[model samples]
Target: MADNILRIAIQKSGRLSEDSLKLIKECGIRFDNGAGKLKTNATNFPAEILFLRDDDIPGYVEDGVAHLGIVGENVSEESARDVDTVHKLGFSRCRLSIGVLREHDYQGVSDLQGKSIATTYPRLLGQYLEANGVNAAIHEISGSVEIAPSIGLADAVCDIVSSGSTLLSNGLKEVETIFRSEAVMIASKHLSDTQKTLLDQLLFRIKSVQAAKN
Candidate 1:
């Protein structure tokens, strides 16, 4: 037998995980979210929560494995999954910015021509560079993008910036903001009638909680 309860995916760890759990708790969905659990069934609501990497949430929802997901917009956009964003929760705010060594004499994006860049988001970086008509070698790296310039791996780097602290520590300065992002709620494109009704109920609760916070 299959469970009819809705499944929601959230970040296993990182900036979005704690807040995602808080949102579910605020929505009155009581569940045992002990440490190290991958999935949990709600005791008071007809929902199941799955903890996973934020990067994987978009695909999971798009594939209908999860009915809903909470993830950062940076990930959602970069992944380009077919899921729909139902709500933009005003938290985990950040921006994807182009950073260079603090000593670089950068006047504008044009200065990046023919320069090597390191980033995890190659697609997003490529689109921005193409739109600006700047040609730069993109060195795709999974993490520690800020260290690229220091290690002679790249002339500039594109990465997420919240407070500019990480870049500062790496002797880099943010020169341009290419993308702004925050936590958002995404849903599967296809939903059954029953699933839609349940989704409506969940949305109502989320809206109510958000309204109360404001």
Candidate 2:
């Protein structure tokens, strides 16, 4: 590893990981990921890849552990870490939404009052509920939030809905969308001059690829 290498953090797995690597390849960068390595050196670029959780990417970037990161807007917002959105990757599109059992007599947002809502994104969900004047009890669950209602853990659940299959399988219906999100490129506040130059180059390539999609 070089002393001044630009480390870019990306999701180790899940929807954003594939596209993140694909975009790097399309941009003419080559990296080798043989097995379960945490960090991989790019063969054709002046950057190193750090495979990390999407939710933790923003914090890594903000703390200067990573020079840049690829993460979903939802995770970035939910993390509330100090970082800059360099580009919207236009992939892994989803919405943070409030959901309840299909049989629940959900009329509108008002029906959520005094209800227990389970969610991974408590901060964002809380903000949305507060703005809507709904006094819902938020139950913070790390994952499987959709199952909360069915298991009697909560009256409803707030979570990210992509194709809505998870909600459908769990017998939940989306009632309110708190935020629309997609994967994005994020940068830390601190960067050396050489790293900044490299970042600019990477951003240019990303922009070119993004434009080609449109």
Candidate 3:
């Protein structure tokens, strides 16, 4: 491993991982991620890969644990982590939304007053509710927020809705969208001169690859 190598954080599993590796390969950056490994060293470039949860990427970058990261914009914004969004990856598009039972007569945002809402993104949800002057209760769940309404944990759920299958399966209807999101590349505030040079090269390759796709 190079002493001045750059470290890039990426999701270990789920939707974005395969595409992230594919983009790296398309950019001629060769690296091997052995199964069940938390970190991998790139062979063709001075870079290391750190596998982690997508939600944790922002913090990793902000803390300088990883020099850069690929993460969803929603997670990054929700975390309120101090980092720079270098580029948009144009994948994993979704919406942060307020969802409720299909039968509920939710005419407007004001209707949620005093109601309990379950969400993974409590900070974002709380900000939205407060802005709308809706004094709803926000229940913070790590995951499976969609089931909160069905199981009576909350009257509604503020969560990511993609394809609407999960919400449909859970018998919830999206009432309002809090934010639109997609995958983005982020970098830490502090970078050594060599690290910055390498990152610029990587970003150039990424931009070329992204442009080719468009």
Candidate 4:
């Protein structure tokens, strides 16, 4: 909570977690991350790292509980928090897609009219549906969205698609991509002058690391 130190939130465990940690180390920020530790202080940089649920990262940054966060763009937009997406990490790339039963005569998004779609991302799904002028019922569920169709829980599903293997295994076929997502750095709007300067330095290092890969 010090004005001079930046508090960066990241997913504790998920596809983005390792990439986030690697980026920080690449930025020359050293810290002891003991196993199961929820938080750690950077030994070289004026920052602290808070490991949290990916879905909660944006809200923590928006509330200034953490000065910054790295999360998927899908989660950020779905959370609808008032945090600034300062940079795109360009990793943990995936898409939010709509899928239907493989046996169904799937034609297009228009075929979803009046049908119920299960998803963890109701907001994003709703937006995509509205933009396409398609009307459907959105059933928000916490997890196991892909199995919705099999159990008769819903007619279709809106979920994250990485390699499309999961969908195929679940007897569903991806029909439409609603959102493309990758890891992104988000900053709190209430950063102090000192914190902002430190963030700039950290970003400089990150960019340098990224440049070296080319």
Local accuracy by lDDT, each model: 0.93, 0.90, 0.90, 0.95
Report clashes for each candidate as comma-separated counts: 0, 0, 0, 0
Each candidate's TM vs. the true structure?
A: 0.97, 0.97, 0.96, 0.99
Candidates 1 and 2: which is better by lDDT?
Answer: 1
The candidate maximizing lDDT is: 4
Worst 10 residues of 2 by lDDT: 1-10
Q: Candidate 1, residues 1-214: lDDT per residue as tens digits?
A: 1336789999999999888999999999999988899999999988899999888999999999999999999999999899999999999999999999999988999999999999999989999999999999999999988998998999999999998899999999999999999999999987777778888999999999999989
Question: Candidate 1: minimum summed lDDT over ten consecutive residues — where?
Answer: 1-10
Residues 1-214 of candidate 3 have per-residue lDDT tens digits of 3338899999999878888878778879787767899999899899999999998999989988898998889999999999999899988999999999998988999999989999999999999998998898889999999999888999999999889999999999999999999989999897788989998999899899888878
Better of 3 and 4 by TM-score: 4
- Candidate 3: residue pairs that collide: none
Candidate 4 residues 1-214, lDDT tens each? 5799999999999989999999999888899999999999999888899999999999999999999999999999999999999898989999999999999998888999999999999999999999999999999999989999999999999999998898999999999999999999999999999999988998888889889998
Candidate 4 ranges beyond 4 A from true positions: none
lDDT of 4: 0.95
Best by TM-score: 4
| Model 3 CA deviation exceeding 4 Å by range | 1-3
